[model samples]
Target: MASKDLAMGMTFLTQTVTGILANVVLLFHYFSLCFTGYRLRPTDLIAEHLTIANTVIMLSKGVSQTVQAFGVKYFSQITRCTVLLYVYRVARGVSVSTTCLLSVFQTVKISPMSSRWKQLKAKLPKHIGLSVFLCWSLNMLVNCIFPFYSINKYSSKNTTKIKYFRYCSSGFPDKITEALYAAFVLFPEVSCSGIMIWSSSSMIFILHRHKQQVQHIRRTNVSHKSSPESRATQSVLVLVCSFVCFYTLSSCFYASVVNFSIPSWWLLNTSALISTCFPAVSPFVLMSCNSTASRLWFKFSGFVRRR
Candidate 1:
């Protein structure tokens, strides 16, 4: 491999491994809590689902791209190309959808009793499982076209017609067909983005009101420490901000892949890195916000030290 390719491969491997481990630690934390007879909170349930989706996303997209960087020809078969791409797209969509659900759920939880979203707070928990299931199913079905469109790595005869990646190429969709497919693929993403914006905005409004109330009462209260609600809101706000940033970058990269002829390896590497970042970073953010996660982290650290 070229020096730059080697460097990119190493970086990709490091990011992928770190993301995988972070998510595993979170899953272990949640399961340990359950094993100790602690009832899982609704947020905990969402975190669990998010962690699993992140793990799948990292493995599917990150590992594949990393291996490709090393010039390994794993996606030579049409079936393999389709399957890998399908899994990556589906997992990516689920990650976005789950984050949207998480943001909306958090907003509803903190809404005032008379607020319209408060009506959803009660029903959210009951439907969370089903909602997650539907998200997976919907993405799976929508991205099913990937396999049909993915060209085998060894199929060079048709490369001139389609946009080819290092190991696989996308099917040539005529202008109208491509536009329609793009719209179809983007519907969930657009919906998720809209939900995140509305939820995060409402959360900011609520937090602002809450701070005003705290200001009025600060003179009488001895402690000015942040409440759990405040901490959680901060964490979720960070999640929203990070997702928006990363998701926008990823989307730009995707657009560039279509619009820019002869895209560079650096662009590809950057896209992969941006796509994996949220899954890698989100578990740590959740861990910081939850007491149980923190205790579990200390316990795990002690166990590691002893070993």
Candidate 2:
């Protein structure tokens, strides 16, 4: 037990530090580009927002998980729990919604000239700020119920059971209210998932058609470097796939908690661990997909090694 606790604490600490470093590096890359007089692309703007959201996720969720892993018991305090829960939920929701937007935006950006969505290219850039603003506002409003639904007291304290994750739950009301609250939370999430799926599908279709066109033009099976569009498509696919894998795993565990299904302490720990994986992994994904960030990271690493 002691060894396991120590391992978990180390894991949480490593994840927290690594995630923060990745985001900081990515942000610095963008700032460097701006300082050197390069105009920020729409994708760069979205990447900046996404990095900020990831940083928040790492800080809030990472601290909570680290504290829990060490059995700190600080979350047992109602005020602490409320603040942590609010920050985690708000940050997480924004991250999810932002990813959906990024996927969709990239899809539209790469759409063929004759495609229906290609018309959005001109107007989309103008709405980027509005869209990001609305995403943050909507998610903030969605998470407003955090205080109402989170308490430092365990569900075991109440006769009327409520589903809850590792932390204390405010013990929801009767069936009707619980159903309503669940709907409120799940609605935007479901919508975001739908948008991501649609955008991913569109991206795949466009890539396939482009590939066919190129093959037809060449009439040969010759190996060639990937086009910029193809590279962008591949990157989006990776980001979407990673998000789906971690999101699905964590969502299943979260559902178990909400349904009051887990009986073991280990299961709760597993859920917490799964929930934090995406945030911990996401910044690295962004850095890998972004060429400027990748180059900057390599340069920085070389300079450090030489020192």
Candidate 3:
């Protein structure tokens, strides 16, 4: 293999393996907590779902990209291409929706406990499972059209209106069909993203206001340690900011690939790299930010040291 191909394969392989392992660890942590009869918070449930989606994203996209980077054709059949791409798209959409849900849930969780807020907060936990189910259902329905248009890469030669996706190809439909597809795909994602941004901004404002209140009450310049809520808010903010940054960049790269008649290998690789960044990094971010996870990690490290 060329040095460039080898490097790309290694990079993707590293990302895929790291992300899968991290996600698996996170999942195990959650399951262990549950099995120990520990009550999981609503956010924990959402985070568990998000971790599952991230694992799917890594397996479907990251692993395939790594294989393709090594000059191996993984999606050799149309069915394989369609199924993998569809699953990846659905998982990605679920990740976005779940993140948005997490942000909104946190916003409600930390809001001032007015009567209205209290009512909504009380109901939110009850609905988390339903909300997640809806996310999966909606995305599955929205992206179902992809299978009909998907074709094997080798079959691209027979068609002029196909968009090449390295190992697979998708037939470009008529303008109207394309426009409708775009609207279907973009609407839910855009809406979820907007909600996430709004919730994040509300969280920032609330945190700032709370800080001001604390400072005024203390009437001193000395810094005080943050509460659990504050730390969690900060972590969620970091998470949302990272997701938005990586998602925007990935979208741009994806658009560029689609716009070109024949996207360069490097462009495709770059897009794939950008797409996997959030999945690869998010589990570590969650682990570091979570107090329980931190404590568990410290204990594990201490045990290993003693051994």
Candidate 4:
């Protein structure tokens, strides 16, 4: 429950406007994936996962952002509060799961034959879908408990303010629930992030070794071919760096949000913005690195212009 008019105005201006633009970008990307039809590249796990993540982000943010945008008007109502919490919580889960899947897939793609993670390469697609469904369902449960545990009644002394959850709003959850929520946050993150860093480092090492070999050949031979592979490797390096930085920042923001003592509205807004903006921003990053995506995006742009 928010008491300040300034807060409402801030949320509307800072969160609402940015969120609307981010969601518009996300929807465009998601629809573009479907329109270009995963038909051309049905076998590419990276392509499929990226498209699915974008779609999920768009759906979750689309509902939550709209609800929040209109929430000030419906602040006093029970249904609106429940809807807001449900959408917000579900969106949070979907965001985390999609990111975890992305990191894991990238890691597996770059890993060696003897890599312990090779088994995942075969089962990952089915596993990712199942994981998404289960995560969404389970996270929705945590959010649903809010309706039963939370209260949206007006403040005793004022007409403007509202209070949520008489008992459940404050601190630590119950033993079982706390454990479950903690597991949800920790398990995938530690595992996914560890593998991502390892695999990324491995790729960078491989690229460097190849570069060294090329340099050796250049030193001995009078004529050396200036190749595009170096450029491709540089692009991949840039792509990896972008993903790592954005995802790390988003995770940090989310961690701060879990602490009940945090009072910064900007932190909350940034966290939400990062979650929604990733899907929209990621395609641009990928397209910048890959000629195929760049061409497809241009083709899609031309089609949209015709309409």
Candidate 5:
């Protein structure tokens, strides 16, 4: 392999390995909490699903890209390409949906407890599982078209409709079918992004107002630290901002690829790398921001040090 290809392969390999490990640790922590008789918060439940989706993206997209970058003929078959493409698309959609859900849930969580808010707050936790289930089911249904359109890279050379990727290719449909598919895919993504922006803005406003109200009291009380809600809000804000930044860049790269009649190999690699950034970084974000995860990490580190 060329030096550039080697570097890109290593980058992808590092990202995939790191992301998978971080997500595994987080997932195991959550499951351990459950087994230890700890009741998981609703946000924890949503986060677990996000971790799973991120892991899937790492495996299906990140690992494949890495293998292909290193000059391996992975996903050389039509069936393998189809299955991986389907799974990656579904997982990518679910990641967006779950992140939007997390932001909205946190916004409602920290809102002032009015009667309307009270009812929502009371009912929201009960439905978190259902919400996550719907995210998975809807994404799966929407991305079912992938299997029909996916082709191996070698097969793409015979067809005029093929859109090139690093390891696999996507068969573009007729104009009407393409428009319909784009609509189904873009609508949910746009809606989720809008929700995330609105929720993040609401959270910022709420946090600012609370800070102002408590400023004098905090100054007077030496021991007063930030509240749990405040910490959680800050974490969600960071999560939302990071997700939006990475997702937007990824979308732009993806758009560039789609716009070109034949996208360059570097463009393909750049798009794939940008697409995996959020997934690779998000677990560490959660681990650092979440007190429970932080504590668990510290304990684990200390235990390792003793050994």
Candidate 6:
């Protein structure tokens, strides 16, 4: 028992340290998100939405990580755990919604002239933001039903402490409800991915044709070269790739959880980590792909002109 307790303590400590680091990096990324519109363009709400999504995710992760790092032996009040779970739910909903919106944004940005995907290119962010707000409100209502229900105090002192973290859950209200909800959520996600892939593929095709034409007209003084635009396109591609993998894995894992393939306790400790990983991964991917970020530091320091 003592050895098992020590192992849990070590795991919590390691996880917490990493979680804190993720949040720190996310903070810098959040600034980039803000720069997306406020400095870049306030009307450019996609960057704002992405930043908001990442912020919520990291904060949710911090809440879970801090509590667990208190060590397994430290007992927490019902309010604390309830708060943690709620934070996780909100963060996750924002992350998924924001990512979905971003994927559609990419498709719109790169769609061929004749593609129907271009039609939604303009409305992507607004629709996504509205959808995010809607989903958030729904999640809050659903989660509240559980946390406030049957949240009973135990012990002579009325401790109201979770022996193993109780009061509200990640569990669905019922098996049928969980399955139906999973299908509903999963459908849009799969459809979005498909559309993104098709749109990106068409864009790549167009780019290739343009490249060939430019090569043929190289000495005619009419050829155009891709400069920063190519870099921007590649950066968007990287973001798309990141989500493809992250979303695929996360969706599969959630399906397993809903289907009862994963044990409940394991899901409890580990699921929160996935929230940190998704938004945390995207900004870094964007930084690596974006030449714009390279000029950001120098611009801020007055050492170089803003690109």
Return the lDDT, model 4, position 64.
51
lDDT of 2 by residue, 1-307 (tens): 4988889888888878778777778888888888999988777777778778888888888877887788787755665567777888888888888888889889988888887876698789888888888878988887888776665454455435654455564566577777798888877777888888888998899888888878865566475778776786678777877787888888888777666633466677777778778777776777776787888778876886799
Candidate 1 lDDT, 8-30, residue by residue in tens: 88988988887887788888887
Kindly report which residue pairs in candidate 6 clash with one another.
37-41
Give me the runs in candidate 2 sitting further than 4 Å from their true place.
74-76, 154-159, 162-166, 217-223, 261-263, 299-307
* TM-score for each predicted model, relative to the true structure: 0.91, 0.89, 0.91, 0.59, 0.92, 0.63
Clashes of each: 0, 0, 0, 1, 0, 1
Candidate 3 clashes: the total is 0
lDDT of 4: 0.53
lDDT of residue 81 for candidate 4 = 49
lDDT tens digits by residue: candidate 3, 109-146: 99988635789988989999899999889889888887
- lDDT (C-alpha) at residue 139 in model 1: 87
**Which of the two, 5 or 6, has more lDDT?**
5
Give the CA lDDT, 0 to 100, for residue 149 in model 4: 32
Superposing every Cα of model 2 onto the true structure, what RMSD results? 2.8
Of 4 and 6, the candidate ahead on TM-score is 6
For model 5, name the residue pairs that clash: none
For candidate 4, write residues 119-222 as lDDT tens digits.
Answer: 87666656655665675677566556545433434323422222223211322335566557567655655565666566567667755766675786779988
Off by more than 4 A, model 3: 153-160, 219-223, 295-307
RMSD to native, candidate 6:
7.0
What global local distance difference test value does model 6 have? 0.54
lDDT on C-alpha atoms for all candidate structures: 0.81, 0.77, 0.84, 0.53, 0.84, 0.54
Error of 4 at 26 (Å): 9.5
Off by over 4 Å in 5: 152-160, 295-307
Listed per candidate, the RMSD to the true structure in angstroms reads 2.4, 2.8, 2.8, 6.9, 2.5, 7.0
